[model samples]
Target: MCNDEDTIKELTVGRRVGFYKVRGQIGCGNFSKVNLAVHALTKDKVAIKIMDKMRLDLQTQWMLSREIFNMESLYHPNLLQLYEVLETPSRLYLVLEFAGGGDLHTRISSGGKLSDQESKIVFAQILSAVKYMHENNIIHRDMKAENVLYTTNSCIKVADFGFSKRVNNRNQALDTFCDVWAMGVLLFFIVTGTFPFHADTVAKLRQSVLEGAYVLPTWVSAPCQRLIRGNLRSDAHWTRCWVASGSHTTASPTLTPATPPSPPICVAWQME
Candidate 1:
């Protein structure tokens, strides 16, 4: 029921979102909800993202359509596969690949700190997909852990590009930065097992993000040949600053919060 756990909650008066029989609600939020559904004809399982037209007018709807279009056009193991779209009078249905491992957040929450090598592999896989999207002129503005899904093969697939926009020209900078910002958040959550920049209040969260303050442990700095390690020259520069500030805003920032409390010293990754 993890995917279609919403068998009990009431939804907008209508039949199941699409051909997939409603197993139950997977998850829900302000903008949309996910349901576990099975195909009526093939009996194949899929996750359906149900969004109400009433919530979005022309602009957002167009953006969502673009996201769906982007997913539909791509064929990558690291990206969530989009099947088809089914529309009704009240809501729009997006048929998607059923990823069973769940989002990266669930894995990080239950798996604990990943190894440095593990982090490297995970980040490399993610970067590969992002690089592909970049070449395609698409920017996944929201790249946090919640938007990433793990396939049964232990592969991390980037999903949920609702906040993304395509940038065809080099001059397009607006809204592009949010994508990397979301990545930083994904990293923070992966290592810390917590939303490093999370806040209970909307206004408060906004204020904190603007502060550009976040913290990580100095010990997490493993000796490396890359750019990530060299940046942490002193205590105040990276780890200390973030722990004191509570938000990380740096691009390519070497932010890897305090070490795991204790667990045979797990390998830390670019978590989220």
Candidate 2:
């Protein structure tokens, strides 16, 4: 059990919490925090995400609930594994698989565009995960490079399902297809070495996404187009690198550490 009287600063870096013991800080947020934790007995590493009730509203609460629901309903290797959840009077806890490689956005920002084979391998795993989610009636509404993470084995682990939606038919434009659009955006970043959806502010970015006015810049390959257009439906297989949101080509540039956007609220989306 968590102690209500324990202030955030007083929380030790290695204190035991429930089945897992805190190892160190892995992530931090305004309302909550994530820690690199370990299974008490097994000593296995895990990522613990804590959501603060005090900082959340009813709508945010709903998003968190839906994300957990979607994760509970599906299983796939490429999808981030959610092992257990613990609730406290003041917070909600999620114990998830540890991906030490970190979010894909981090890798792309420092490494620039990945090679075609690397892109293919990564895309394949994402496709598999998306296909599995679709089969189980789930849609990943906010798919993006930052939301896409990787395991230590270099396999894909699509993270963050907060924005995912459920669809009964192919014709509807639910959050799931929006995730597909986000996926296309991510692929554009991976292949092109830049964010496909360029905007100076959040409101503008949202407008661009809703309008679907994404235009490809020069350097995007023809096959990239096929990838984006083919998989925006429930029946479609998640294959190929999509170029729907932006061009897959970017000017040759060196990479530095890049600052990424936060995950989309009510929509678990993020960009590198």
Candidate 3:
């Protein structure tokens, strides 16, 4: 069983945590640190987020509980998978699927903005994951590029549910609309390599968000521009309908030579 002594040892490299062998630190937060590990039996890689019980305030504890509950309830291809939860008197460990390809923020910073086709692929997976979450009554309040991870094969996996909540009422416009607005910001960031709303200070940023003023890059296609506009606008219901219908064309046919395509495909709905 896990004890305080074992928890201290687990923080060091080359220590065992239950069935997994801890390797090195991968990531961290205010009260938790994530370590890379390998399963002893299956030999599969995983990330173990170790949280100190003493550091968690009452509010943080409540958020942590909600995160665990939401993650445990979710089972989607594009959502990060929680393998198991282990606890000691001092620390709590969350075993999760390891995404070796890094996060979307790092990817964009290192390689610049994604191409139209590439953005469509990545955004479709994110959209799919978000749709699944909303359908299940879960709201991922924190939806940003940093939380979007990639597998070794380049598949998208949405992570970080600390700000997430499950609501009993699906018709709650305020809650769901927040996600829609975030989706718009995410799309704008991936396509242009910048946030749609920006300011020097927090107060100014809030004002920018309230004003809802942003200019689409000239390179972005008309349909995608329309989609982004629809998402950021006051009509959250219209944005939902557009996303649900999956009809917006992210790529512009006019930009390229007019050649008959071999097969018709809906790129927005293609998660894989």
Top candidate on TM-score is 3
Instruction: List residue ranges in candidate 2 displaced over 4 A.
Output: 1-14, 168-175, 199-221, 228-272
lDDT of 3: 0.79
* lDDT string, candidate 1, 99-144, tens digits: 7778777778788856666565565456556656765667787787
lDDT of 3 by residue, 1-272 (tens): 36667554664435887789988999999999999999989999999999989999999999999999999999987899999998777778899989887999998988888887778767777777887898888989999999999874337789999999899876763477778788889999898988888799999988888888678888887777876887798777776665555444453222112122311112433221
Task: Give me the displacement of residue 73 in model 3, in angstroms.
Answer: 0.5
Clash pairs (backbone) in predicted model 2: 163-268, 264-269
Candidate 3, residue 11: the lDDT equals 42
Residue pairs with backbone atoms closer than 3 Å in model 3 (clashes) = none
Q: How close is candidate 2 to the true structure, as a TM-score?
A: 0.72
lDDT: the better of candidates 1 and 3: 3
Question: For residue 53, what is the lDDT in candidate 2?
Answer: 83
- Model 2 accuracy (lDDT, Cα): 0.66
236: Cα error in model 1, Å: 22
Ten contiguous residues with the weakest lDDT in model 2: 262-271
On TM-score, the stronger of 2 and 3 is 3
